[model samples]
Target: MKVGTKEAAELLRICTQRVRQLLKEGRIKGAEKGDRFWEIPLFDGKPEVKEGRRGPKPNWKKRVSKAISRICVNQHLIRSNSKHGTNKPVIRVESRGIIRYFHSLEINGSCKVVYRPDKPLSCGAKLWLEVASDVMLTAFVYS
Candidate 1:
């Protein structure tokens, strides 16, 4: 006997839209589309969904646009693999608590650290950083 999509969806334990999609994909044999409804054969039983990828594809390829400057916070020196220049304006700053960079701002005190600012800090180039920090920081820089 031929049944409508609603009845076929109920017998297949799926939604009516899924049944319609199966009919459109020609997975449900002997199913014909009428003016606005689908006529599915009752003997076709439940069709098995093809086992394949489910979600969106991942992004595996990485493109680097900026030259990375590695900084050893413990050593207080910056290193770069790019041969463009030895004194590039890019500096990799890593702080345990907070890290802040200013163009012409210098902080000096009797504490254990003193910062002296230089002119012409960065050119028209942009800076991009990727950082990983944990909760409950205690103000300590790691190499």
Candidate 2:
């Protein structure tokens, strides 16, 4: 016997819209359009959904309008790999802080005496860092 989409949906545990979609996509066999609606064959197994990807879409990719040309600056940010890029302009005046850069990545340098960031830094196109002046001056100054 043939059944309406609503009955088919209830029997198959799906919505009537899904049943219509399956009929439109030809996924549900033994179903044909009647005078006013689709007639799905009764006692037939549940309709099988098409196999495809089932997950949230991936994030959009960034497209560059121009070539990646490196822009040179007098100083470089130490944590340039941060999400917010390099030296973004900021207005923080009247604050006591020491502007220093990391020097050699020596073996003993990582040996740890507790307080780091007390090492002497090299100037030029190297990394630039900023630390509180009071803590920096009181911190251990490594050779």
Q: Write the per-residue lDDT of candidate 2 for residues 1-143, one digit (tens) a residue.
A: 56778856755656889778778877666788978888777532333334425554322112212211111123334345255565442211112122322222222111212222464233232223232211111122233
TM-score of 1: 0.31
Q: Estimate each model's TM-score.
A: 0.31, 0.32
Q: Candidate 1 residues 64-130, lDDT tens each?
A: 1222221222112234424433433334343433344322222221112223244221421232333
Give the lowest summed-lDDT range of ten residues in model 1.
Answer: 60-69
lDDT of each: 0.42, 0.42
CA shift of 12, model 2, Å: 0.8
Q: Model 2 residue 75 lDDT?
A: 30
Note the residue pairs that clash in candidate 1: none
What lDDT, from 0 to 1, does candidate 1 have? Answer: 0.42
CA deviation > 4 Å runs, candidate 2 = 44-143
| lDDT at 142, model 2 | 34
True-structure RMSD for candidate 1: 22.6
